[model samples]
Structure formats: structure tokens, C-alpha cells
Target: MKNESQIFGIRAVIEAINSGKTIDKLFIQKGLTGELSKELMDLLKKGNISFSYVPIEKLNRLTRKNHQGVVAHIAPIAFHNLENLTLKVIESGETPLFLILDQLSDVRNFGAIIRTAECTGVHGIIIQKKGGAPVSADTVKTSAGAIFKIPICKVDHIKDAMFYLQASGIQIVAATEKASCPIYDIDLTPPTAIVMGSEGKGISNSVLKITDHMAKLPMYGEIASLNVSVACGVFLYESIRQRL
Candidate 1:
């Protein structure tokens, strides 16, 4: 079975990369060695594209066709360049509201966040190129088509994006349980980028250190943590509330 967004075979994958296709995820059979495979590897390194080494069985499961030890999932949408998008947003005279997902791993959570971010007037969503959920067909379905409405930026590093946002006069606000203040206390009216971490791990310590503010939703239940998507909605709406 052929996935609509998937490209198989080393030559095909390499051609896709050269043609500037955004590879959401790539799977290469372990111990794959050939001249074509080497060419793909070189292209991946040049592009800083990440791939996972998996057993041939995994590759077979991904597709029944001849993959030549490589299979790549093409991103459903083109990713925006962070600097270019940020500059455009600032120049447009809009209070730049951005969402930064720090290696969030769940596809459903990712989709929900995108939907909410779009509904809440987020200018863009920034995610790390690696260690996060890929924007796939499932994401498109789960987001209920909101994924196509908003711009998404994939960066090499979360901290680098934070630094760039800060340099652009945007404040970095991280949502985490480890924060001393509640979400309501933060002033979100300025150009702001809210950072949400993975479901298992809240914001990373290094990331939290650079943020202008850290906030948490007040918890009252026995389960102290909310789902990442739910938490994201609360945080985004609070900004909306404060801005309104």
C-alpha cells in the first residue's frame, strides 16, 4: 500500500530533497549500504534532515513496494522560515503571537494545539525539526483543517528560535508546572511566544531559563497535570483574555 505523502526508494527520496520537499519523517533500513544510499545520506546531512534507522521489517510495514532501504514521509504543508516569518509578522504591525512546541511527541496533541493556535489568532507555530511529532495526514485530520490555515516554522533548535524571538522584541513565555506564577498573572499583551513542552516532560530547563516568564495553570484535582493540548488551550485563551 502506498501512502499518499510517502516517497520510497533512495533515488526518489534524494530527488524529493533536492526539489525542496520537506520530509516530515524518514525511515532507513539498518545497515543499508550502497552508492545510492550514500548519496541520500550526503543529501540528508547537507539539508540537516533527520532519519531513523529501522529494521527492514519496519520498512516493509511502511510500504509493500520496493523502497531500496529508504522511505520518507513528505510534509503535508510547507514550513515557514522562522526569521522570514517573524520579520514579516513584525513588519505587518500585528502583535506577534507565536506558539513554540518544545519537542512535543504526540500527533493528536500536536493537532489539537495547531487547531487551537489557529482559532486563537496565533501568527505562527514553531516546532523543532527533530524530537517532535511530524505533520502527517493524521495531524491534518485531527486539526480539522486548521493546520493549513496557519504558518508553521521548523527550527534546528528551540533555544535558537527563542533567542531569535527575543531579539525580534518578542517575549518568550513558557508554560510549566515548575513555575512560581499562575497564567493569569502574566501580561501577554505584548508580542509574545508561548512555549509548551512535551506531554511527559514539561518545558526543558535550558529553555525555561531563557524565557521571560514561566506560568502554570492552578491545579485543584488529584491529577496535577492536564493534557498538553488542554493546557495549551488554557494558556492561549488566557493570552486572548488578557489582550482583550
Candidate 2:
């Protein structure tokens, strides 16, 4: 049971890393030991590649082939460099519209947001390297191939990206239910970056502190919150509407 995006076996994973392949995620069986495993660990540390220790059963579930206690998911697409993409967008003379996902974990919701972002004319999407959805085959399918159409960047820290965007004159607008103002009241005509949070936690307090504005979608029904993907569409379209 080999997934096209997955590479198993310690030697194979090490070779992939040595060949400069971007690893989306890596799983090593707990207590895994051997000379090759040692070499893999050393390479991972040297490259700062993140991996998790999991039970042998988990490795087995990932692939039926002999994993040698290691399995790695190759990033389906090459991620863009945030700084370079931002500078390029600014230089192109288009009012930049960027989407920043703060630890968004659901794969389907992530896919849907990517699709919406592509439709709404987002310049680029920025996601944290960890604690976010992987751009797997499912994401490619769910996005209906829009994943390739849009530029996506993986950053070490979401807040750092926010600071860079702000310095680039892009206002950060965070979508959260806790905001005092409705999204419609915010002016989005300028260069903008919309920040959407995780499914469970709307937006972290640390992230909220630095945003230029925080806005909430008007909710009429008893349900207080909307799904992240749906909410993201409303927010992005609002920006589009204001720009138009």
C-alpha cells in the first residue's frame, strides 16, 4: 500500500532528504534504532526537518512495505518563499490580497479555503510549517487543482509573516467572533492580508494583538459561529466587493 506522495524505509527517506526533497511530514517508530536510523536522525537534525515518534502500528498503517520504522510524506507541491513572493507581488503593481492561515488543521477546510482564495484573487497564501494541514493528494483533489494555481508559502512563524506583511504596507485583518465590529464596517480597499484561525480556536490572542482590525461576520441565527471555510469566503468576498 504505497501512496504516491509517501516514501517509506529509513534508507529511502534519508535519500529523499539528501536529494533536497521537501518532506511534508515524517513518522518514526518509537524506540527505532540502527546505524541507518542514526544516520537519518542526524540528517533530519542537520536539516531541521521535523518528525514525530509514533508507534510501529502507525507506520504499518501508513505503508504495508517494510518501513524500517520510518515513513515520510513528500510535499505534493513546492512551497513558495514568503519574503520573495511578497516582494514580487508588491513589485507587480497589483494591490496585494494575501491569505494567512493560523494553524488551520482541517484538510477539507484548508482545501476549500484555497479554492475560495484562488477564486477571490488572493495574491498568495501563507501557512505555518507546523500544526497546519498538509498539502497532500487529498488537498490537491479537494482544491480541484486550484492548489497548483495559487502560490502557497510555508513559514516558521505566522506572527513573523504578519509583521513582514505589515511592514510591506499590507493591513492585517483577522476574522474572529470576538470582534466588536462587523466585517462590512472594515475598509478593505488597501493592500490587505486576511487571517483565518483554526477550527476550534477562532484566533489566538497573540495573533489578534497585532492585527490592524478584527471583524466578525453578522450572524442572525442561534448558531454563533460559521464553518471556517464558509467564513473565509465571506471575508474574502467582502474584500473583493470593497475593492470593486
Candidate 3:
């Protein structure tokens, strides 16, 4: 991790959290606990910060400093609140174009998708705090710095985010292989939010059940699937093409 990308040590992380810093991801040593650490953990949960427990060796790989069982990666960009962003876009009299990523955990893929999103004029990108990729230095590099140009919203649950988007009068367009509809056939010019799924698993069934539209790219190769990032580019650019 780059020096600017992360904060090591428990107290430093706690301070960053207290200051309302945007932490993209957090790692703590397995079985970590001190009176201070417990306090930090409590604040993390109350704030809905996403974190994971990792081996001390993993922490050593990230940094040589005394981490005291916790490390936090600073988000490459400030996170936007989905509800506020959604409403703000509508109030501005522009068609709301959002990209929702469901558990796309590969940092490289996440970065690539954001790069395409920025190119497509996507208004914002939404992801689940726990299941999605961490916005690390590698992610920023892979994104060609597009991460800084876009708003990323980290939500508690993908389904909840979908529901809120629907309620906000945005049509949710999900891309999945299981769907029969072609991507280019959709009405992308509306107030719309497109959902892209994880590299390993497609969007969760709970999320798919609520989608306003489901689309799939035309396939001609023997391989039945496209990479998550490539699929996202196809979806986003098609949305762009339709709008244009």
C-alpha cells in the first residue's frame, strides 16, 4: 500500500475515523482486542464502516510499522450518500445515471469499471461496503485516476440500495448472463441505474428480483461469459450510446 493510501496503527485509524475520514477498507489482526481496540470496533460498527480480520502476517505485508492490530486504507475519492446524490441529480434537471456494482471484489475490475463509468458520464457508482473491492492504490492506478473523478457510494446492502434507487424514481437495469434481453434494446435515456454483478457470482437473487430491467450482451464465442469489467464497459457504453 502506498503511504498516502493507508493509515497504520490502531490509534491513528481511530483518529481518522473520528475525523470522518473516508476509509475504503479496513483490516484488523485476527483475534485483536484491547480496551482501545474494542472502542474502535464499536465506533466502526456504529458508523457502518466495513472491516475484516486478517492474519498478522498480512498486516506485516502491508506495512512494517506497528499497526497494533488494525490498518485502514484511505478511499481514493470521497464517498457520496446515495439518497442525497440521487435526489440532487434529479433536482438539477438531469437524467440520473448511476452504476451499481454488486460484490465485484476484484480491485482491478472495480477500477476498470469506474474508468468506463467516468467515460460514459455515469453520475455515480454504488457498491456494498463489505463485499466490493477495496479502493487501494492499485485500484486508483488501474482506474487511470478516474476514481478521483467519480462519486462512489458504499451501502450496507445491495438489495437495500436497489430498493432505494427504485423508490427514487430511477429504473434499475441489471446485467446478468441469465437474462434473455440484449443490452442495446433497453431504454437507457430514462432516469436509470445499472447494476453489474460480481466476477465470481452474478448479482444476488434478492437484488435481481427487484430489477426494473435485465439485460445481456450478445455472445458469439464458445466461452459463455465475459469478464466482469468488459461486461460493465459494454453495459455503460450502450447506455451512453442510447442516450446520445
lDDT winner: 1
Clashes of each: 0, 0, 0
RMSD of 1: 1.7
User: Which lDDT tens digits does candidate 3 get at residues 66-154?
Assistant: 88888888876788898888888889998999999988888899889889999988999998888678888778999999999988888
lDDT of each candidate versus the true structure: 0.93, 0.93, 0.88
Off by over 4 Å in 2: none
Give Cα distance to truth, residue 204, candidate 2, Å: 1.7
**Number of colliding residue pairs in model 2:** 0
- Cα error, residue 181 of model 3, in Å, equals 1.6
TM-score, per-candidate, Cα-based? 0.93, 0.93, 0.91
Per-residue C-alpha lDDT of model 1 across residues 1-244, encoded as one tens digit per residue: 6469999999999999999898998999999998989998998898888889999999999899999899889998999999999999999998999999998999989999999999999999999887899998889999999999999999889999999999999999999999999999999999999999999988889999999999999999999899999999999999999888
For model 1, the stretches where C-alpha displacement exceeds 4 angstroms are 55-57
lDDT, model 1, position 106: 90
